[model samples]
Target: MDFFARSLAIAGLSVSLAACAGAPAQSRPAAVAQTAAAPPPMAPPGPCALRPSCDTPFPAPSKREFRHNRSGLLASALGPRHRGRDLFLLPGTPQWVLGKFAYGPADKDLKDEDIDVYLLRGCGAAWEKVGTYRTTEDEGSHPAVVGVADEGGQIFVNLAQVLPGGPLGVGRHRIKMVVAGDGTSVDLFLEVLPAGARIVVTDIDGTLTEKEEALVGDVLTGNHSQTHPGAVDVMRSLSGRGFFMFYLTARPHWLEPRTREWLRLRGFPPGIVHTSVTATGRMGGAAASFKSGELSLLKTATGLLPELAFGNMPSDVDAYWSSGIPRTFYYKLADDARGGVKHDDYRTLLPSLGELPAVCP
Candidate 1:
């Protein structure tokens, strides 16, 4: 939970305007309909309303750091230096396809670097050129019509500008960024959700993995991760039922890429991943605050709180309670009478999977 907010930021990979609030995810034979509360009166279609996702109150710190440049073997070992910030938006809101760029083993931030951007519908192999953008020195995203990256390693390629005419469509799309210097690139995701979509949000370190320190132990010892037994099947099944899976964690910013990699490696359902860039989360005692704050942003953006949530910390309980999520489960805790259920076995919920609602259009 200590790493929750930064992870939400790193793990904060998403939002869905006009999403719905509903009961805890349960299995029943009936198809359920989400209880979508009406969204705030949207500003009439205009420049402001057309804006894509932006940095929340706590935006990422875009600080440039210099390091001994790395290439080839060493660079490959440290993994991809550039990572695009994945975004989720309701159709009306355009997306600022943002990314962080760096080079070498230490992820030395790159600036004034030229990049080629491309778009691939449905993540197919065929790619289409979008534009040529440059990494500038700005920390905040104010992407021009062309596309841009800030010195803080942040890139903002506005969807309204690239795919002009309308907001990006529903379903997943890929945004590719190729560094002009090395011809190397990274692919980030853009999940465009429809109004009143159903979503399931969860934390990673403990909620998904076997325990809070499990991930750290695995990373440090170079061992395979140990996920809670049914975590994978349960999440994948939820996705199959048309529920959007949100993997919100409190990991640090730099870990976002790895976090996504781990989820993919572990067979967790595909979804946006968010990690925090804040210095105060987790051990700093801001995990709950970060989560509630982020949840509040999501509530306003999507017009609904998550229908179901999972976690394993007091902070998680606190965050969910404040967000008013109806169904929240903690893997480790006993059932709390106030709220939240004591449940961890995902397989047990499989029989009644149909009870969960299909996402609303």
Candidate 2:
């Protein structure tokens, strides 16, 4: 069998063993194609490359809030599994994020812009830094970038390697990032969930949130806020039932903090919110491609498929179907010819376990 087909069979075997959650997982010969490979390294850009005035033609920003805007860590839901066909899942498994340095306030720009990121553990005043990570230079692809001003100053930080285990233990963890130049800092939060038999995947816009009939501007701006009724309650119910929730959206990476904050403020259960990093993510097939790709990675990396998926757009249905979620389980907010389960809102959808077999292998 081909690699993907063999992996599916292995996943099926895992489902058959679901009744015996305590049984030892099966072991199999390692496939050469399953090995994890490090990403290719590129030459580090100069320190000030991310600033507007740092380079020719582009000028620094006049506003202060713009200094650190659109900067934070990416979230991870599933931890790395020690054994399985997905043992070596890389890009999506090991926690990583693009870190940006905050510049300017009193027109005093920083020269030494190295950043230090720490993983904070515990809640007391004695909170300790459990891990520290170094940043690798990379170009930012945010769609809102004007000219070439903010492209070069970004860096990628990997937290998985520095954590106690490859996967963080189940709990809430806060990441602290500090720019060595002006002492400016920011914090991002993430939670590692306990292993469960099924996962709940849903789209953000129009699926979980309510959209007005005639609002024409950007629907996913950082400040755009409106969610459907009972959306949070339904997700909370599913979370209580032991299904890991994943929010898949076509929004850009820069809006991650806003999206996360919206979900938190609205009482939704905590889960990783996946967004697009590319400048062209909303164009053409970008959204569908990204959602489908992430779903595929989730399955390939952890061998778990989403037991239930909720979406509104045709792209969502297409992506969920491509990711192997059943049409009956793929619920849509609107009735369409796509043939997935239809729901007016999340109020009536009670996610049930035991429907999806446990993922193994």
Candidate 3:
């Protein structure tokens, strides 16, 4: 099946919102006498009402070094000039490296130059180990080297094969370099990109909010609700960073008003909200199969290629993972590694979110 058809098949969009929310007895539409059907139930004002804490201070930028030899061979590798020239070993050089990692044969000869790299995480006065690498003499073939580099200079600290499972996640990673050798050192910052452009697809339910159970209950039973801790802040951060924030939910599209309001109220930056639509032309739940179909429609409409996806339920996680999003951020009330990677709660994971670079590649 085509990608769109696959997404719709998985989404099951035909589910009626009324059925999902358990329509109120008095409010139910009359089969025979009603002149006009009551307008779809108005969603509570401000679906997203919580705002992020603007007062929360951002961490200071961190500094590191990117030193390379005149021949360009890294010291970690067996070479005469492995240490490379200390590009910014002097007092006035820029204090960060901001570029992609460079690699070469174990014995290939190269130039010694200085470059600037940007640091993604590990900011503040303290120095955090964002990345590390060792050199081996395998010049016959291209040895995967991961580190920071720029127009002036480059530094290779780790082997590329150690990534995804190492400090840098699977796709791309940002790092800081500290030139350490002899009597002088310089700080360099760098951002590493994957082989291809990638995007992250995340969920709004349990993954970003503590009120997962409550939100699900309200969706399934038409109960009033409140925002959860850290939900607004996380969404804001993700939005500010330019991620395509998609508020994908099983809730019906008719809830758009309430959903938009809730986001504004809670300070979630305005984002594209996707929800279910009813088969009879209303909103909300139908059959699980129908809901899956609607999901497929939305996916086709957006044409978003998700590299990573975050969700709470096993089904959602499995669905996204199976669809080709490799990395998964699985959130749970309890910490357990059953179906995927789990977090204690969103807050515990907040620090890591900060680790992500503020700028997108």
Cα TM-score per model = 0.71, 0.57, 0.38
Candidate 3 structure quality by residue, lDDT tens digits, 33-67: 11221222222222232112122222443433434
Best of the candidates, TM-score: 1
Q: Candidate 2 deviates by what RMSD?
A: 20.1
Instruction: Give all candidates' CA lDDT scores.
Output: 0.59, 0.45, 0.36
Candidate structures ordered by lDDT, highest first = 1, 2, 3
Q: Candidate 2, residues 114-177: lDDT per residue as tens digits? A: 5555554422233334433333233333332211123444444445666554545454455555
Stretches of candidate 3 above 4 Å error?
1-200, 213-224, 279-303, 333-339
With candidate 3 superimposed using the best TM-score fit, by how many Å does residue 21's alpha carbon deviate from the native? Answer: 19
| Cα error of candidate 2 at position 122, Å | 7.2
Q: Residues 56-99, candidate 1, lDDT per residue (tens digit)?
A: 12212222222334433333332345666776677677677776
Supply the global lDDT for candidate 3: 0.36
